[model samples]
Structure formats: structure tokens, C-alpha cells
Target: MAIDWIGFSYAATLALGGVLGYTRKGSIVSLIAGLFFGALAGYGAYCVTCDPRDVKISLYAAFILATVMGIRYRRSRKLMPAGMIAFLSVVMILRLILSLL
Candidate 1:
């Protein structure tokens, strides 16, 4: 199978979210659950798109996740968890918008 950069990046983003969640909450369960869901969603999105053209769903999810994380970070005053998610979410949103154009 061909390698999908976007998919890989998405997966990485999910894994990062898990890491950040663990660091912020000190809950291994959060990390594992996040990774599991993220990986699943990333792989699913990757397969569904087969390219950058169909990034809407992924983009929407990314945007939402980012927004939520940003808010979470603001409230908790934590940098790593929320910051990382927000950052990646922004990147994904940008990519999605670009893909649309």
C-alpha cells in the first residue's frame, strides 16, 4: 500500500493528543483511549479520502478538537496537552481549507 502523508500526520496528531492528555491529567486511560480512537479515526479518514481531496470530515473533526483543546488549555492553564492539540488542530484545519481551494 502506498504511504499517505496526511494520514500518517493525522495519526501522529492523535498519538500526540494522547501524550498531552496523559501529561495533563495523569491518566494512562486517557492516553490509551485517545490513541485508540485517534488511530482508528485517522486510518479511517486516510482510507476514505485516498488523497487530500476528501478532507472535509477529518478537517471538521480536527477543527472541533482544536477548538475544544484550546478552551481546555485556557481554563486549565496547561500548555502541553491543550497546546499540542490546538496546534495540530490548526494545522489540520489549514490543510483542509487549502485542500478545498
Candidate 2:
């Protein structure tokens, strides 16, 4: 099976964000939200890369979610989640921009 590193990284970052969010916030809601959003974004990355039909919508949603989470983390003064999500969001945004070229 071919390894999808981009997809893996996307998923990992989101999942990590969730874990960190839960750890930092000490709330189950953060955990659930993180996992849900991570899975959604990871699936989006998979669809965008593998599917021939433009799955750009998913990428947009993922980006938005990531950005929101990143801001949340930042506001909470949690460095890891904030930094991870911020970087991941930027990378995804760059990838989306490049795909347009």
C-alpha cells in the first residue's frame, strides 16, 4: 500500500491538537471537538489528494476548522496546540494555493 504522508501528517496534527486541547483545557468537549475536526480534516486531505473530482470544498472546511482551533489554542496560551495547528493550517493553505497553479 502506498503511504500518504501528507494525509498522515494532516491527520496527526489535527489529532495532536485535540489531545493537547483536552490536556490543556481539562475538558471533554475539547477532546471531542478536536477528534471530530481532526478526522474531518484528515478525510478532507485524503479526498482532495486521491479523488480526481475536485474535493476543494473539504479542504476549505478543514482550513477553516484548523484556523479556528489554532486561534482558540493561541488565546488559551497553549503553545503546542496553537503552534501545531497554526503551522498545519498554513501548510494546508499553501498546498491549496499551489493546487490552483
Candidate 3:
């Protein structure tokens, strides 16, 4: 099987998002869920494109989505969660690296 870097990064973000969703109020959980679903949709969109194109497409989508989520979470004072930042950080960084390669 091929080592799908974008898929791995996407899956990792999802896994970490589950942990980051933890919150007593549950809103953070909801936000992470939103982010997760949004990412999933974007990733699905990326998959429909052809092979070599899919790589850059997925990475760009991933980068944009993660960046937006991070910015949104940071600006919305009420939505910031403990682990979401880390999840975004990892996903964004990985996406950038993969996009470069």
C-alpha cells in the first residue's frame, strides 16, 4: 500500500480532534465536530480529483481548512479548546510540508 501522507495527516487530525473536543460545556466538542466534518468534506472533494493533482489539492485544502479553524477558534474567545490548537498546529504544519514535496 502507498503511504498516503495527506490521508495520514487528515486521520491524525481527526483522532486528535476527538481528544481536543473534550469540554465540560460541550461547545468545544461541537466546534471540533464541525471542524471534523468540514475537513472530511474538503478531503472528499480532494479525493475526487486525479492522482498527482490530488496531492497538492488535498494539502492546500487541508492547510486552508486547518488555518481557518485555528483562526476562527482563536478569534471566537468562547470556542478555544485545549487540544484543538495542537491538532490544528500539527495538521497545518504537515499539510505545508507535504505541499512543498
Best by lDDT: 1
- Candidate 1 structure quality by residue, lDDT tens digits, 1-101: 44557756777768777777699879897699578758765864786467656665676677677888899888988776677777877887787677568
Write one digit per residue (lDDT tens) for candidate 3, span 32-52.
764675566346444633343
- Looking at candidate 2, the ten consecutive residues that score lowest on lDDT are 52-61
Off by over 4 Å in 3: 18-24, 28-35, 38-50, 73-101
lDDT of 3 at 27: 58
lDDT of 3 at 64: 57
Arrange candidates by lDDT, descending.
1, 2, 3
lDDT winner, 2 or 3: 2
TM-score of each: 0.71, 0.69, 0.42
Query: Candidate 1: minimum summed lDDT over ten consecutive residues — where?
Result: 1-10
lDDT of 3 at 54: 55
Model 3: which ten-residue window has the lowest total lDDT? 44-53
Alpha-carbon error at 12 in model 1, in Å? Answer: 2.4
Clash pairs detected, candidate 1: none
Question: 1-101 in candidate 2: lDDT tens per residue?
Answer: 33446755776766776787678878787688778767877777676667624547556755786678678787887756566677777776777667657
Point out the higher-scoring one by lDDT: 1 or 3. 1
